[model samples]
Target: MDAFSEELMRSVEEDDQEKASVGCGPEIHLPWLSQHIQNTVSHGHKGINFAQTTSICLNFIQEALLKHQWQQASEFLQCYFQALEDFNSQKRQVALQNIWKLGSAILYHHPKSSVETFSAFADRMKNIGVQNYLKISLQHALYLLHKGMVEEAYRNLNQAESWRYGEMSASQEKLIKLIQAYRGLLDYYTWSKKRTELSKFDMDGFATSAATQDMHSYFRQASVNLHEIIKIPGVWDPFVKSYVEMLEFYGDQDGARQVLTDYAYDNNFPSNPNAHVYLYKFLKKEKAPEDKLISVLKILHQIVPSHKIMLEFHMLLRKSKKEEHHKLGLEVLFAVLDFSGCIENITAWRYFAKYLKQIMMEKHLDWVQEGWSSRKDWWPTFHFSYYLAKKNWKENKILALEKAFTSGILLGKGCKYFMYVSKQGHKVQEKSIKTMKKFVMKHNILDSKEL
Candidate 1:
């Protein structure tokens, strides 16, 4: 029954705006405020006292300068923070988040760090406990990983995982498991150059298992991605290579290789160098003609000469073509020139440094004149494999993986290699996953998902 309401209604009816919105609301003026000041002096109200009371601050010299009174909008924020204490603690929490929005408007794009206000908010986060801990820790891990402090990220991830598990919920446990699995894959690739010897805690095993379980379903769902890879020359690109590698290790090389070859030309599979690793693995597993291995290496060199591992591939290639076993052995010997230094010698480190592709390609060849040495150790072997691959020191660029995987034979590190190598195993029918499998468990086998 205010005159404003009567006027607004009459205008709405006249303009047929009753059904349309103008997006305006009723606000009060001072004399207008006294008329109903008792009814509405809520924060946003513009009562009769509004102009006068606001002027009190405008009138003050020292205080007006504090806010650059020209930007009266900023004062709204001071009023906002004051209003929050009136609510109970829970609503007080929400008020703090809104405080950001309030500052966002008044800050006029000047990056204002309300450190004083944020400190209180941060304290609230700590008070909230476990849920907040997991969220904050996970975010921190993401930050560390983004900054390339992968080790720090994993450490923080461990803290987050602990918090999640402490919640004692099976659902939460699965979530943590999946996330850990994700981190493991990243960690494995990030540490691809550290193949000298795995850490005491076994980060290698952790990575492989995570990929196997979490990503097994990815093969089927990843078909679109696989098709893109097929467009590349050589039936094997990273995806196909991984698929074929996995199948062959599952005890079916011929079958995998056949399927891979069928799709080889259709999918633009690189028959020469890209497919060399699977071919070599298959050639070794099956008693195929040695000439086949030599042909692959020859094709490898023709395509890429910078391959540092060409020497190692030469060992296999020369031997494979030789009809007589004795002649083959001799040729293989000369092909592999014995560098005078050792397991950890600067010479070996040179190859390791030469090949480092981000993904593991292995060139672990550690020798000690007459005996074995740390140069051949699993971790360093992988580290160097990656290093040499980067240098393209071998024509059979992919063959660098041969020395890398084979070196794992000494310490039984083959399982770790198998995890990666098998992903591209030749046998598709055998290795092709039919449906998404749940991450059941983990073991030392390269067959399982560790990443």
Candidate 2:
């Protein structure tokens, strides 16, 4: 038995009779597991064959597990462990892939069993160095997060960061950043409601705002990504706060409030992003805001006092050291709401609205609705209420669409102002110009001139 051919030893050890699998052997290939047992199954000798092929057995099992072939994985596991008594350290290290797969399978497909499998993986990981293990660790962290294993995932992320030296590629770094972003953002009020951990991996790639805002940016479709990023556990709070301040400095009140209220609310809530989103669309339709969203939001305050964006702006400015933004906030709000949505930050919106209206009782800027009847280029988002309240929406829809386009053009132009907003659910830019043209034609206005 000791004198058996090396290849024969391999085959004999594996108990696989597919002689065709024979690497460099003199014998015909044997495929049937039973035949290997029969040919080499002399009772005493049978167990030795299984021992030598432990690596192969484990690999087969692991592949099955990764593929979600749970039934096959179970069978492979049975066979693999039966032969485990003889596997050496070298064989074990060589079989790490399978071990990782098993860990992943348990965590993702069979959560109740994951604790044990993950413990096993941990032991295996300790024996290994940080080379290939980092990737596995990162994946494990992501899975743990998904399974609501927050602390474990946090520990793993720290460890993963340690391994993130100068060796990783840019793509790998980006992926790691995404993982951090994903893990950080899960702490938002919305996601925490279920007490479920967010996935660490960006399976949908929504974590880091892309280099260029795609169809899913917060800037384009405010509410969704806004909601997504604020909850993550990373340094999201500071990042969002700093970012909103920057938008405010840049005169992007709509942009800032989207961050403030929707993504991460500061104490002075800007109002839900919908207020900014809808009101901006109305102003933008009239070629308003004219590249300065801050000024645009101000005028919006003049015409529509109860506008949510201006309310948030008033809150932010109320604390301004310069007093410019604060005074401006009141002026704009007074002009826009016809004094409807007033609020004293030192007091609150309720008392302020009442006092402001009592102070200036001329009808709210109901006159701003004058030219809405002549609205020419509003399509795609023609909700029934839109046509019913044409003046209300004419400026909002046009400006909203323009800001959407400007954001894209700016990103493509590689402005210093890229990534100021999260871009989620932004299907405004179709990949195919032809498709957009066809859509435009289908929604042609009554006048060809409007087209």
Candidate 3:
């Protein structure tokens, strides 16, 4: 399994590299820009003069350079740079934006690039100004940290830190604080590294595990770090979910519940599904009574009427085998159908069909249609086919087979079973296995391989 997992990871990484390589290259948008320029000229627009034309042309050149189309970019700069450079201040600012944006793009998308590319980019940006240079350095450090080059990241970050006392905009300050918060989290994760009692293994190529020697101490430290970040303006609400996860990780059920319950009271609370899932898991761990479980599920269903919660509710009822629980499961299926069309989610329809079969078999039900039940489009056809084959084979074999085929439900293994049962030659039927065979072949529903 480990070997298979490693191979899968490598396959995924190769696929990512392939995608990144293809994505880094230029996309041709010159035709669109030409059309725009023609439209502006036709409109008799004087403001869209040579300077404006030069600006747009320079923008295109920047894009070409970013994509490593150096020859095309050079040609464009030679044509337009002289015209653009006539506006001294505006030209420098535009150049700065182009270089910075391209640097960010290359760092993010082109992972095959060496660290030396970053150093060269950093040196080029130094001519922009002191504050902007420091900002780029911090960003570079963060990128290094992401690549697991911790020592290099720290050194770069320290150098940036020494220059932090200089002038900075509000937005820049906020970004720096955000990076510091991430750095603190990284430091904690690094310090707490151990193999035992970790979170579940990651199948994806990113994080592998969250290991720690002391669970309690680790939770305390993580909580402190996260809370401080949370108090900062503009930090996302989802970060609070991590603090709740910490409690759950330590098996502190009551603590996790209290946090979720309190958070849910706020008017602006984010309808985070994971919070409800964790609460449900806590309820299960405590072995709460069935009523309490249902109550929690009701709240969960109310907030996020997702397929997952409904499926869990159905399974919980199926496990109990109580008549009321079965009825509740039926209602839950109706709710799911109402929320999502059967075509939108085939899996949910599949589950609903299984539940329908179970109820029909156990109760020998004769269902009557109300306004809602009249919607035959929402019916679980596969389950209906199975029910007909099981219950009415002797009474009306031909009709049963016809309904099953028309519904497009019994084409696979389901059809195989119907064939088996029909071959047994039960008493009270007008039709035989031979008739069913004709119907299957006539419609060409299943291939010979399927049979």
Candidate 4:
């Protein structure tokens, strides 16, 4: 058996032994217990403690979930719901919050059930006069959108927009704005698809049709709403992206660029990394100058050094023949390895090796060696340096010997294969390799194996 299965079996056996020692009987059938508790709660069984029974059912559901017994857990969940149905109005409000948490965990594993669960939950919330029912509708709409049910998602959003639950509180007001933003996004999606369909058949006919007029009206409304929405500083990525797309489609390139730039520079918004990412992507799409792209990426890099896109930017910098650009590319690669969780990126390591080779080719040996000294703590430097030394041994014997010796000392047993001794048995080569092996034995760096 695989290690994981063996470990799981061991753990289960240990747990059963512990339970037996504690006088707990054999495992109860969770599905049967769940149905029994649910029947008792539903039938209003006399003398049954509601709180204690509810707690026990919830505990069984959690145990079943830990065991990955989804069917049994689902049964226990229904029993918990039945118990909650008996709660008084004030208690029901608090109980609804707990149900949302538990329901999210259960429903996430069962998408087919989630559709019914979300609908039923929304109905329950609305019947209770809960203001968050609108938010729930919006969440349901987003889920529908993810499932590619655009028409259904639009219906949900439209229904939510019509909701009038007394005076709006501060939180509800924000929720309304979010709902409107989504509505605008849905309109954009619908309009874009219709336009694509019409363009393929009769563009002139579509331009003057009622559908075109409706699309224009939708566009105007979305543009106005998104303008106001973005003016209030926040990370409004979807709204901003939709707004920019609509503007670009309508032949407003300058407007789109301005919107992207303004969002990236918005001081009121907490420094959002995506804000800068949006601007960088937009500028790149526009075929902006290298300097402009570099400047924007520099800011983004400072905000999030580990961002994956930084690697692409590093390649862009490497295209330039300028020494400064090459140096910048090296720095970018180092940052990506150090901070981006890409420590084992072979492409990056190979790129690093190539860059060092270029520097070694162009600069004086003393200068290159000085740079190597500063970066000695990083194993890739020594690892790649050894390969470079072996490849160019005939042209630069002195440099090759130095690199081989240092790499052996730092790389330990891993560097043994890279240590080449010619059949000619040059005394200098033999002496250096021997000294390198001695250092490898005495001062080995742990886990410095080459990639």
Q: Candidate 3, residues 363-401: lDDT per residue as tens digits?
A: 424331221244444344433445545554456454444
Q: Rank the candidates by TM-score, best first.
A: 4, 3, 2, 1
The model with the greater TM-score, 1 or 3, is 3
* Residue pairs with clashing backbones, model 3: none
Q: Give the residue spans of candidate 4 off by over 4 A.
A: 1-53, 66-68, 82-92, 104-118, 202-211, 306-308, 315-326, 339-347, 361-375, 378-451
TM-score of each: 0.26, 0.30, 0.52, 0.67
Index of the highest-lDDT prediction: 4
Residue-level lDDT tens digits of model 1 in 1-451: 3232334334424433432356433311112222122333555655545334433322332243355542343444443343244335565545444544333333332233232223323333323323344444554455456557777677766665566334366545544654454354444343333322323326545445554544444433334334444444433344555445445544566657775555532434434555655555566667666676665555555555434445556456434434343233322322232332232233333333222111122222222111224233334343334344344323432443443333333223333332343234233322221110111011111232221
Relative to the true structure, candidate 3 reaches a TM of 0.52
- How far in Å is the alpha carbon of 204 misplaced in model 4? 9.0
Error of 4 at 149 (Å): 2.9
User: Could you give candidate 4's per-residue lDDT for residues 61-133 as a string of tens digits?
Assistant: 7887788666667667655654545547565455555555565566656533545445554555444435557
Off by over 4 Å in 2: 1-95, 119-123, 126-129, 164-176, 186-451
RMSD of each: 25.7, 21.2, 13.6, 12.9
Cα lDDT of model 3 overall? 0.54
Q: Candidate 2 residues 208-253, lDDT tens each?
A: 4443233123233323333344544333444464344334544777
- Cα lDDT of candidate 4 equals 0.65
Choose the strongest candidate by TM-score: 4
